[model samples]
Target chain A: MRDFRVLLWLRWRQFSDGLVYWMRVLGYNPKSSGFFEKLYPLYLLIISSFWVFAMWGFGHDNAVNIGSNIHPTSLADLLKAIPPAVLILQVFVIIVALRSTPLKLSFADMSYIAGSPIARSVPVLLGFLRQVIFRLVIIAGFFSLFALVLTRPLAQNIDLSASVRAMLACIPLVVLTWALGWLLGILRLVYPGVSRWNYLWVLPLLILLAATYLPAPFLWPGQALVLLIYGIAPWWVYPFLALLAIGLVVAFVWFGNRINMILAVDESILHARVAALGLLAFRQPNLLLRIRLQSAAAGRKPFLSLPKVYGFQTLATRAALSYLRHPFMLIFSAVWGGVMAQAAVWIISNELPVQLWIGWLLVVGIAPPVGLLHVFRIDVEERFLRQFLLVDGLQLLMADVILPLIATIAGAMVVWLAQGFEPEITSIGALFIPILAILLALCGAVALTNKRVLQTRILATGITFGIIMVVGVNFSPIIAFVAAVLSIMTLGGMVSQNA
Target chain B: MADKSQEDGPLLKVADVSFKYGSLNALSNITLEASPGQLIALVGRNGAGKSTLLKCIAGWTQATSGEVHILGQSIKQNERFVREHVVLVPDTPPFYDELTAFEHLQFNAQVHGWQDWEDEAEELLRKYGLHANRNAFPFAFSRGMRYKLALCMALLIEPKILLLDEPLGPLDPVSADDLWEELNGHRNDGMTILLSSHQLPQEAHPDRYVIMEQGEIIAQGSPDGLRKSLHIEGPLSLDALLRSAIKSRKAVKADA
Candidate 1:
């Protein structure tokens, strides 16, 4: 008990010190800050509160509108989809937990706490709480609003009862899912021998696949939660879920008592490196990606080699070979394209408000596929490696991005074809995918080559897309294509000059 | 080799070069020259602009003013052409995370349009004691091994002027000696070498020493010439040279 208290105090001190450092970075030193500087955080809080309330108000109004206009059959279909979506969400959580061993310790914790005679359950419990707290709050809040929308169709007045019930149901589901994930991860960490089992992370997918053949029991948890949200489940359901969650937590803690400190420290090294980066990790995700890739490839042999080729072809083959070795990057590129295309179709087909278009544009601009300029960024950034490549900047960029661009286009085309649009529209949309992919790649390469900040890059991408949309809507697709091609040429020249 | 008539001229020259990081002068009016078959030791304290000078000479960084010339041709006007003749291996060299050690050399050779480079690449790995790890990624290598591999890559190109920044810092003593011997071989072949170091191997000797302090060259000469000019009483070493040069500069400042 004494050790636990001390560990908790250490954790608190670390958190406070980090907060102080971040505040100082923002010109608010805790030691000698002026009154105005001290009030900066309060002012930020008030502004953020206003923003959150405004977003909630807008979302609630949209939900009400949707509830009233949506067909009764469609509501039933949505309710049906809810259970499967929840199950899939839990599966994703499990897969992610397995992929990175849920028990993470920062370097400080590994050095100061891991080697000490403290009970292992303390850090395990603390880590679980830290990981789940923010996620629990955010997920419950979103589900509460969703419950309001579902209840609006049946109730004449705004009732907080169903939303409260939904929030309550969501709390247990999140805890229970995370607890299960933690249990599996703790088991893996407790016995070092289990880690040698190749593709252990794939076990979750196998379980999910097996669940498809036994849906009734596999989906009961999700269905029970939905039933609770509707205020129709028996009184025992929520309590059962709460107890199950507690039970899993206890099991994981019990398993944690036997964790191998060496393996745990080894697994946490990657996390520690990224956590040490602080805000830079968020600002420069490529650094995070590089760290993750290095961790993944640490002890593994590469699957492919550069072909015996010459000149630009050598660069192209090397990029292709890298993609082959790490096919997950290509998979992510395809998924990003598919998801964005589906969202774009949803907006257009439903004739939704224009603000959603802005939202889509923001996502497209800010979160261009991670693989879009992955290799190209390294090429331009590493002066040592860059000197070896005799090619110009534009050629290098194009060579590195060709495979990912093709994958993205293929993904978008598949989504478009699945949507079953008219022949002419399908042809036009298909034609637009390659152009948009190329334009996106060029914008990223240009910003990176010019050493622009991320915000500036996002704004540039947004403005370019806006111009294209305006021109295409007001004029002709052909003219828009010409303008886009011209912009590509200009951006290409900039990249080349900078390169 | 590209210009036979220019063989008589200095191989590498930095004429009145200056560099600034924002308002801080990193290198000010740093002028130096290296003739063929010369090995120059760039001795300086930390942050004394040795690395910065090497970068400027390599054309990896453009100086604020003045010129870096290779074989009498301005690097600014002929950067790509000049780069083919000059290479700078930074202190902490970076390599591709996806590439094996040997693949780095292969990529370098292929990009330069070289044919039948396998034997040379293998020899370099063996010479550097990296042959066992040729199939391993450089990210997995120790710091000293990574530096050695980087040196091998630079040597594979056989540039006319080679600039090494703190090359001895990451090397073991024996490896350092081996490096000096190999550098001696290159120097014999007319490859001008400029390396920044606080200390040299015990058995190794450079043709000249260019000592710098605070971004400015304070003293530069052969061992005996520097000893005679500075009126030093003891056998010359980098530490003594630096101290005497700093004292003389301070004295001059006080007099002014």
Candidate 2:
């Protein structure tokens, strides 16, 4: 037990040290005696409070009445109510685990640890334990809050024992979900392309659960017998259910370990291939020039000049070339276009009123700009713009803002066309409003914030999305215009402040 | 002469090694060997496959054909062995963007399980005149400082073989002198060093120099041996000798 405690402590220290190292690399000094540093703990406390409060508020009614008076007549209802909460809790745990483990077992950190004389198993075990502990704490906190808040209200109507049993039944389910999430997160390290496909697993699991119609008597004999005596289910089902749950947990752990091993091997090979390609491509002059140009454009420069092309053509050409090469842009365009096409057909066939198309327009309109932001931000982060500043003898401060504006305009045109020219030529003019707004926003962000425009834009967009969802606002042209203006102003203010 | 099997083992051997970038061959049908504790200078013009050869030996770039054996063990069969035994100080050292000299040393110590090496790292940093800037990021440093930091990292690893590519490119005279002193120390410790540089210093005294052109080694011998064979002045610089060898090779080919 002492040795175990020591190992845990050592692992925690290593994880913390690694996090601190990376934070320092990113120019963050959390321990510094600055105003922001002092307030950081308070800020974290506030965020955690917000998360807890929001989750509890959303979950309270369902938690208290889990299996009491509102007896689930169909398996679909039971599955829907149970899986959502479980999935949400699972996602929370997975996010915590994913965010923590990278710090503990990053390539650089692992390189150091692997060289040590200590047993290889020690670091691996410790890294896994740290991730598990972080995940468990988040899950336990949410569960405990739900249990405390909902128990009294739920017990008033339903047999408290049955309710408690049902909640207890969910423990293994949560663990299984967590294990699956961890496996997927680990897989991402090896096959980054597959990481986004994680959502596909949940639908199948939910479907399977919905199909299950086993009654308590068969599924949990000991518990059913006990519940029957106490007017819950029957107490006979408890022991059987408990054993099944134990088996599930064991299976989960085994699968999780298998995933870890598979991913580790895959990551090792993938990294080697990337390194080899990097070496091979390093000496190619044309390739190097392209890389240099694209890197510069991404760095948020307003203009780049080749030996041939002068002025805006230089910057525009570079931007166009970068967009052409970017993989995510292709993926986003294909997916967006496909989804929109399907929706347009579905809407026309259903005759679901003209207003429904407005929602589609809004979604389609927002997709391109958001996608362009991602591509633009990659360049920013790579600091490719800095290289252009040296070569082109032109200030790229405006170029960075202009490139995104152009992409946003192009995206808006696609969205406009997808709507089949709604409101005819008049709507075309209105489309310019949003494009201009987005352009202004992007420009303000890049010009004012300089380095942090991308991050701020994302945060602002998320906040806007949350507000729109919570308020249940109807899609309107006027609302779109207002949003465009506000976004532009907000981003512009941020950029100006930075400048 | 190459048939001596039971004699002293070659420090490095690359047999039938081929490397390709897509369809373009970077190295092909290449074979080379070096004796234990020998300092071999690999001289080639840019794009002459010198860097690729060094990378293959260092286990950074795997050969597409055949094998590279360091101390008689195939690098493919035991990469960890190569990693532990050989270190590559690339022309542009891969640095942690954010780590300071002190932090990097601490990381190396923890990674290598050298519990008491913090003191050693500190002493070395002070010895190398990097003590004052120990806490600064490598990005904040000059090119020369970055080179020193890389050199310091390489020194901390203490590998049996060091493969350097233009290691002296960014160094000032004083740092170069310090580096030469350190290299002398490593030589005394029987560490085999393989390096390529366009500008060879007078003091390096590399045991042999391999002059390559158009992706093939055109001449190989001790610096003195090459000079004597070619009837040149005593103690000729590697760069001058290489230039002379290339000219002679071209003349011979033209005559043929």
**Using TM-score as the measure, which candidate wins?**
1
Model 2 segments more than 4 A misplaced: A1-499, B1-8
lDDT per residue for candidate 1 within A207-231, as digits (tens), equals 6777779888678888987899889
Error of 2 at A440 (Å): 35
**Predicted candidate 2 versus true structure: per-residue lDDT over A128-185, tens digit per residue:** 4555556556655554534433334335553345434444544444445555555445
| Residue B166 in model 1: lDDT | 91
lDDT string, candidate 2, B1-256, tens digits: 2235315568788898888878877787777887656788888788878888888887667789989987778888665567667777777664433235676565554445455776778878987889998866555567788778777777876777888888878888778888888887888887888898887666878888888776667788987778976667755876677778888898889999
RMSD of 1: 2.9
Candidate 1 ranges beyond 4 A from true positions: A1-6, A33-80, A145-165, A211-213, A224-236, B1-9, B254-256
B10-63: candidate 1 lDDT, tens digit per residue:
788889999999999999999999998899999888999999999899878889
Lowest summed lDDT across 10 adjacent residues in model 2 chain B is found at B1-10
RMSD of each: 2.9, 22.7
What lDDT score goes with residue B225 in model 1?
Answer: 88
